[model samples]
Target: MDILSLAKSVGSRVEAPLTDLRTVTKVLGNPHMPLLLALSKGFVEPVYRAAFLASAASSGVLHALAVRPCDLESLAERLRIADEDRPRLKEWLDMGIRLGDLTKREGCYKLRSLPAKALAQPGNDAIAAALEEVLRFHVPALLNAPRMLREGRRFSLDDQDGLVIARSTRVVQPLVEEAIARTLDRDAPVRLLEVGCGSGAYVRYAAELNPRLSALAVDLQQDVADSAAANMAEWGLTDRVETRQADLRTLDAQPQFDLVTLHNNIYYFPEAERVDALRRAHDLLAPGGRLLLTTSCKGGNIGLEALNLWFTYADFGGPLPQADELVDQLRQAGFDDVEATRIVPGEQFHAFTGTSKRVAYA
Candidate 1:
């Protein structure tokens, strides 16, 4: 039957069964199939594009293309795809060409689209990392949430690739640097304790802002802490900054730091424990020392929501803070003059500054 006859039959629950592939094929060939496909492509293409680009980025395909045009074998070899997988690699690159992120001339592939070129640039590495984060973490957090909930399985910290997160967090470097500038006493000697010091980038930024600043950068994970330490050494801040692998809660209440900062990691602590965590940070600060905490809070876009979703389901962390609630948390943690500012315009990212109100907790 033709499209109309088949549809009318299906609509009437008549002769044709909806499950028949033959009938479906006739309907797919109908006059309106182009419009149907156009609508479908609008939703499907972006997903496919993101997945392809993210893979290309993480697998060094973007770099391979940017460095030089490469034929299938050469590119596959550069990407270290096994000889047996070369055909699949070729197919993938061909799809990229069709997607407009890559082009082929003669027998070689080159970066074609502006985004591919831009992401390949050294300066735009943070943006590329952010794209990887979206594909790697955010998408799965949302798409698999239902199954995860049903299975009672959550994304543990180890489930995430810390290196990806550390790199991706730099996407918010500008906002974070502003918060640092607001809190740091640039000319004065300052001692800093940075919690969850992902790549030690912020610590480097702060050290640059204050010539007399020395810092102890700490992360809960050994690998992350080691990575930060390596970055600090490479940045030539080894003499000024010390990197440690330690959880904030285990640290002694030193009360020596002039500033304590936590950026983009508040949700790593459960809401029940945040006050205590903040209190630990509070105790680490000297009298008059300021705590600079920055985080992506509630009421943000899908990206932030996905982040919150991960933390919510994780065994160790909690939901993104609501602004007033976090303000109260800092207060409960014994911080005086707590103030929060929207550091990123039209976004839920915030910078909070508060002074230590008392000596280390008894």
Candidate 2:
């Protein structure tokens, strides 16, 4: 449906305090307003990223401009963009300029301060990579939602070969790390077992935070496990952490860990298996060992709700369970002192905490 028709349909249903049809007329009369609103409501960034990727010299141009402004010819030559590609390159640069990533003056283009800094900083690389992966992989998968739904089938992540999963998980690592730190114990050494530990970000974060903390990071995908191992090694966490490519359900339940974490990966388990997964996590914990679970609950923020829809449509297990339902499951898993707290209230991100019923003697 067209944007105007959609807006009118929505306006008709909303019970606003309006006396007549004039209200809808007044609202939709301003065509630019609706267009601008839609543009601002999450369409802009992906458009910019798509344009950036379409240009062969986009990255090189950004990097070169980070050092110094360059004219079209100089940029083409410096970036090795061929004559045939220069027109497309210029179009991409123009889009970047319009997006405020670059500034153009007197036939030369220069990177804006923030974009320049992002190009120069190593820390921003992960975020950039994540954005690129999302643009390349996730967006395509999302676009296939209608077809998948019609066919009663789901898109699989296997095509991306684990890159999308790894980068996407890493994108939220900081938030998960902060939530874990706030809820988990920090007084003593922690032996953590992180199920579905993508990229080992949380494991490394915890180990770095507590000098005596050690972790066993597990991912079902061998490639992801290998990548996590490399990431741990790069972070100098190899000595304190181990990576295993194994499914959580198949893992030995030895009650060996002081803390077991299931972050953002809970949706991988089918709705029927969720409680069992929680129970298994409980079993893997030492007596009184804490279980920390994090996910966006159903009916949360628009972004999270959209994610839940994609997961459900793609048959990636199931949508995020409701917060209260998750707490009930934790309790049923024989856990004590179960609680659920919002990490970001409106963002729908939350952390669920529970302690195993058995007490530890140290």
Candidate 3:
């Protein structure tokens, strides 16, 4: 199938136009890729990491010496470990230093900016703890991908409904948060539309943060749409956000929103379908309205070897556009000032913004 070529093709077209991830028209949603997303980041790993780190701290005296600017000798002395344990501790120190969670100058270690603050705060060793536990989970899922394919069995991380959860953490949450922070005026109302809203996580976060903001969450799955509805109600945002099960290809009834969002959900369709969906989103925008898109290309953090190959074996039916190609498509679709930014440094996900061409009402 020339899997690599196929994956590369799919990754290219899935970026900008097919940003709405609600539809799964092909083998792109194979359980492997998304499973990696879930384990790498989520409440699932964070909660477990917290517990593991807490236990490691109590028994291992290194916690006391992990403070900023602490020397290796001092750290070793604080641990007071048996000679055999030194190698393990050195390896741990080496990993932490590399991940940017810790800094090493000369022979001393210091916390990185974010973790430094978390560590300084009272009763907050959360960062270190979470990192420890999540690593354990990530390793197993990564190694088991080949086994699942060979055995013709589902991966353990696959959702019961057979969807592979995002292999990446809701890492985009922070990006959206930053966007909201910059665009929102204090105490001013905002309206957001998530075109391929899944489970309402983004909407929920938006509603919770900006009491004055309203949201429209749309997904293709009736069950997921219902779940988002229930969540809005549970979160007391029923009056603020509405959930709907509508296909993006046929969505034509909604009012233009202040902002439209498409998370890392594209790539299930062929080239033509992707472009058509993008045109629809472009047409739906009001004057000065912005559309935000998120997608991963071949250059993204998680390797999509399986996904990249699926395009060839599955019959693309159309050619997929890469990052530059998608941007050009957005411009051609009549969107103005199309721009893209890397939401996470060295990560696959990217954020793009385009404004509808403002037409004068004569």
Task: List candidate 1 stretches off by more than 4 Å.
Answer: 1-25, 28-39, 359-362
Off by over 4 Å in 3: 1-172, 179-188, 305-321, 360-362
Per-model TM-score on C-alpha atoms: 0.88, 0.72, 0.52
Q: What Cα-based lDDT does every candidate model obtain? A: 0.88, 0.75, 0.59
- In model 3, what is the error at residue 277, expressed in angstroms? 1.0
Residue-level lDDT tens digits of model 3 in 233-310: 887888888789877778755546777777755554566667677777777776777777766655443334333333
Give the 10-residue window scoring lowest on summed lDDT in candidate 1.
3-12
Query: How high a TM-score does candidate 1 get?
Result: 0.88
Q: What is the C-alpha RMSD of each candidate to the true structure, in Å?
A: 6.0, 8.7, 18.2
Model 1 has an lDDT value of 0.88
lDDT by residue for model 2 (52-157), tens: 6333222555556767788999988887889999998788778777666778889999776464447445455556555555565556657787787688877555
The true-versus-predicted C-alpha distance at residue 284 of model 3, in Å, is 1.3
Per TM-score, the best of the predicted structures is: 1
Model 2 residue runs over 4 Å out of place are: 1-109, 112-142, 159-161, 170-174, 345-347, 359-362
How far in Å is the alpha carbon of 100 misplaced in model 2?
5.9
